[model samples]
Target: MPSYALLRRRRSGSRATADHATADRTADHTAGAGPRRRLRGLAYLALGLPVGLLALVVLGALTAPVLMACARPADISSWADAARRAALLTFGILLTVGVAPLAAAPLAALERHRLRVLASAPTEPTAPEPRPHAVRFRARYTTARAWREVAAGYLVAVAGPGLVLLAATWAVLCPIWLAAPLVVARSSGGPVALGIGHARSVPDALPYCAAGLAAGVLGIVVLITLVRAQAALSRTLVEPRPDPLATRLVEVTRSRSRLADGFAAERRRIERDLHDGAQQQLLGLTLQLGLARMDLPADSAAGQAVARAHDQAKTLMADLRELIRGIHPQVLTDRGLGAALYELAEFCPLPVAADIDLPHRPPQAVETAAYFAAAEALANALRHSAADNIRLTARVRHDRLTVDVEDDGRGGARLADGTGLTGLADRVAVVDGTIRVSSPPGGPTLVRVTIPCPPHPQEDDR
Candidate 1:
């Protein structure tokens, strides 16, 4: 039965040890394992050495008097009794005064090291299991979480020493030969056994020693167990989270589909408006003017009426052409983005300079978006920003086309309600281009846009 009990305790202890080892391995995996952790441990060891030495020296200094009194034959008949009492008193004082601050140093160092390890951990981990909780908790709860973790390290501090003390006390008591001094002195009942010399007087001292050893061991075990528990909790709580690749891919596909639909809808609206409204009006007006010109020779008053009708027809033709150009100009469709931008610069009321540098033509979608953004910027400069001179520059570089409209005008552009700038912003966004308007209230408004262009045409590149 005793053998069985011993075997069971060993097994339980082994499992606990294994669990702790596994936890540490997991934390190491979560936090970049390898020479780095070992290096950090070495560094902490180096730092902790001086501190440990200082503690030992200071404790020795404080304990010198007690050591002397225990060994002194003149002061006390029994050194064991004096030493044991002093040890109890000293341990109590140290617990009350010194243990807290002394333990804080290692706890703080460990925490700082752990945090650094966590920070250096891979943000995108490939492992299926979540990272050690300590790393995750720190990332989420930040400093507050780290503080709680540090506070929980005390359990380890208590357990290690407690176990050592238990082992030492067991050695001191169980040996029959070692206990002979007390047994012989008690049997003799001499002056040594009575009052001052009680190696013999305290017959039950052996049991008392065993009980004290057990208590000390239990306390230390509890402390270490508590610390390990806290460490496990931190690992389960703190690590970074990963998103499945499938979810991300699906979101991207949906966005592209929506953009394609928006592009097609915008193009159809422009085409229908031009064909139904502008093209038909221009065709009808041209026919009416031709009939009026043919009727001019019949009568003088009738000729004047015919000429007036022709003038009205000519005005309608001009409006139709402007409307058609606004929808999608023939020059842009035929010659490409460069020719369209040049025309825009020429029409601007301000003294505008054009710098068109394109190695090759971009896609139709890119060209259309760039042209309109430039046009809107120039219009804003002419109307709102009271500018005298403006510079228009366009370039296609490294598979990207960029348009910049800069003016030395009163500069206050904002994304307010019903502002044309807002619509211009939306138009740029539709093409996956971004517009940056740096219009500070006094003067000089600049609008720059960049759009991702498809592969350049080889002929245009030449």
Candidate 2:
């Protein structure tokens, strides 16, 4: 080992070297910052100009007639002219009102992408606003947010070209001005014209070069400021507005999911208790009764009583097993939804044609919901459909579980008419699933159930 003083000297050298390296890196970063920001500002201007021009063209085309109709001649002496102007105004208003919302959506999407890529802004694709009675056109098109987007689109169209023009003018002029001295030196002996005078040599162009350098620096500052302002405006207009109702709906959905999970866990607990505790006890009692009957005399009353008790005990045990299955099937827990469904088909009184193709099992709650919905639909078909054949098809596609049940029964099934479908609807709704009934009052009832669930990965490996 070296002496302590020597070691101290070596450590000090290392620290000094590290500090010098850090300082160099920082200086390099500082030197490059202006060019990087200038490039970013240029990119923003280039992108915004084309998008703004496109928006202007489209919006202008859509609203031109409306603007023209508003510019009616002061002299409306003829009734026909008045009527024509009114009709034109009405048509233009209707057209703009109808098409503006659709156009705004795509424009807003482009703006959002530009902001996210160029400004490094945190942004997300906006989901469509939810509304009740969405099937009606009025409900979908008459929202305030839709009009707000249209206004934003117009603003972007108008402002984009203006800002780009200013930025581009400064960008071109600054470079040309800064290179004045070089231009003067390269020119022929004849004088090159400056803004107010002529320069015959590089020395005479010094003032122009100084002015250009100053202007270029100032231009960079202005460009950065304008780019930031544009980004802020785009974000304000294009970003999704926070809706309290939507937020609350999301919270409610999460709470419902949690509750469903808790309920599923509780159901497993109950099924376990019955299977391991009560059902096992009942099985033991059943065996004891069978043994007691064997010991008694065949002709005596005690023997007959013991035999009857044994038969009743066996019946009760089977019923208890069925109850346990109804609560939560062991096959579902062990094998999967596919196996459980096929087993269910085996027990159905009617002939069931089952086609179940699942790559993997879904979540426990989803499986439970789907199984019960299928069971209910099958039961309804059997009791009321009055048809012979029933078909059941289940598959997992695009992260959704779709189960369809169809019957060739005398069909008059209706959800609101209280055919047990309302309960199924409610149950499916708890898991953010949907149930559709298509029984057109004559025959052939079809109940389609769709539940959103991603497949369980571990189950797929098995």
Candidate 3:
């Protein structure tokens, strides 16, 4: 086993163990926390709005009965007595009707805040998982907050009695004022049968019930409207921070694309330089020697010199060939990625395998990128992985051309500041492709390349 392979295997084992250990620690913490969390909730409830509202309602109900009992007339035993109490009864009813409106005003504001608080709570949970639609307000109110909101509603109910009393008092006073003039006139003897004794006035039943009901309905409607408005306001205020992540993603993709184009362009320029400069010069020199051979005698000193030139030209040709191969191997263009990769595997010192499935011929750019990435990956495997074997697989599916370059060697491969794979990655990006390198510092190292399929003609139009 090579050193890199052994190191990779060790790293893989450690990662698995660490993951399990962390999970166990998390579980233990959660288990211990459950009971205490519940107790804190119960404590908040005992002192909170629910308790306050219960006490308020209890006090109101207890006082209401006693007050009503004491206020009732004891001498009213006949219809005539009932008529006396009628005034007080009318007063109470009218007061109740008048007060409902005033109570509704603040009640509406309270309802608005209640809904707003509810919506805000759910939104505050740290980063809920993303969904297709906008996040819904699903705030869970703590017992304390719920109680407080409900208790505040008591203020709305409190003003009810006062409103009714005001209306009833006004009703009584109006009748008395009208009767005062009549009573004075009667005292002056407008009619012998006329008297200034108290007369019961019939209270208007229609106005009392209609006013109270209308006030209640209006209050409820306004409350709902305000609550909805507040919810809208809260959403605007506390929305997710404008996610610049998508913009960053686009920028990164473009940057990668530019890097890819630059890398590819550089390789092409280098290849051209090698072919036009050194390779051309070597070919010319060989041709010149061939022509020189014709003028020299077989056994002559000139002939021997010609022979040496011929041999030198052949050696230089070989050197030129090697240099061209280094730039972009001939096999790559001649036979496409599959054959070129096989040639790469044969040259590797360690064991290697090729699993290639080409559904269709890819575009020239795609093939070129794949070729370079595969070659560079193989070189890295041979030099660093020290692995027993490597796997090279290529396939085209779902409008994407994918290639997987794997080595069973010591993992932990990073695109360092200066590395052949880094250059290869840049090249791959030119065709809107991505490269992911997963090499834990252990046995298996994998490099996956994915290039988006070129758009169809119809898609381009759309």
Candidate 4:
């Protein structure tokens, strides 16, 4: 082992080295970040120029009729001329309304891309595509999103050129100002003309250099600020404003999904604990009781008591197994959904005609929701419908899981009648699924549930 003094010296040297490394890294980052930000701002200004010009062209086209109408000279008082102008203006108005959305859409998309690349700002998701049968022109013209795009285009046309001009002025002046000392030194021995006074020597140019430094710093600050402002305006006009109702609905749906997942996880945990812990202990106890009965005399009272205890232990063991299966079945975990449904049918008293055709297993949450919904429906049918024969059909169709439980019996099953179906409905809703019951009095009852789920990749691999 090293001496205490030597260890202390080594530790101090290591700490000092670490501190130096951290300072170097911080300095390097600071050096890199300033130039990166300035480059981004400059690029944004340069790109905005062309976009602004294009927007101006589009706006001018849209306003041509109004401009023409306003510029109609106070000469030529002919009725035919006025009528021709009126007809032209009316046609122009119709054309403007038609062309506004077409021009605004591509321009808005380009602006969004520019903001994303240069300003690191992401806009809201675009609206979904219209249906094939939808009236494309009318649908495009009527939407608030389309109008917002038009307004954004107008804003860009008005503000973009002004920002570019300001940036250009700063870009030109700041460099010249910063090079004041260099300019003075490079000039002939005669006094160099500075901004307002003459610089006879390098020493005389010091004040101008200081002023240049200040101006350069100020210019950078102004450029960054204006870039940020432009990005904010673009985002405000291009992105859709969040609707309070829609936001709340999304939150509620997410919360419900989380709760459903938690419930499924908890069920699995309970099943695991019972299967591994309590069930094992119960099995061992049953074996012990059986051994005790065998070792005792058949005629003795002790042997009879042992026999009765052994029988009770076996019964309890079976009940516990059933309880574990009910919580979350081992078969469901090991053999996927189709096997689990068949196992469920095996336990039911009524003869269940199962027609299960699944190409692959769905997500765990969806599978759990579907299994419980089906189980509840079948239970309700067996208890209330007095059904002698039942049909359970489960299949994956169009990226959705559909399960139908139909029974032939005297049926008056109504969800509003305060049955278990209400709880089932709530359960299905947690996973964004739906349950429907069609039961007429004195007839066959059909309980159908539909849950949206894509096939699992692991199952696909299998």
Q: Pick the candidate with the highest lDDT.
A: 2
Report how far residue 7 has shifted in candidate 2, in Å.
19
TM-score preference between candidates 2 and 4, better one: 4
Score each candidate by Cα lDDT: 0.63, 0.84, 0.61, 0.83
After best superposition, candidate 2 residue 397: deviation in angstroms?
13
Which tens-of-lDDT digit does each residue in 1-462 have in candidate 1? 999999999999999999999999999886766566556433432433343344344444544554554564565548787676677667655553344344443454443444344333535434545788776544433544343433434332333243344444444544433444466555755423322224444454555445545655664465445434534543443332334686786687568647855764576478667777777877787787778778678468887777777777788777766666676666776788899999888867788999999877776667777887888888877888778999999987777788999888778877673446787777777667887778788867778889888664634311
Clashes of each: 17, 0, 15, 0
Sorted on lDDT, best first, the list reads: 2, 4, 1, 3
- Per residue, candidate 2 scores C-alpha lDDT tens digits across 303-327 of 9999999999999999999898888
lDDT of 2: 0.84
Error of 4 at 19 (Å): 2.6
Off-target runs (Cα >4 Å) in candidate 3 are 1-245, 248-252, 269-281, 290-312, 329-335, 342-352, 387-390, 407-419, 422-446, 454-462
Query: TM-score of each candidate?
Result: 0.43, 0.59, 0.39, 0.77
Clashing pairs in 2: none
Q: Which parts of model 2 are misplaced by more than 4 Å?
A: 1-38, 60-105, 121-141, 172-219, 281-316, 334-367, 373-424, 431-462
Residue 455 local lDDT, model 1: 64
- The candidates, ranked best first by TM-score, are 4, 2, 1, 3
| Candidate 1 lDDT (Cα, 0 to 1) | 0.63
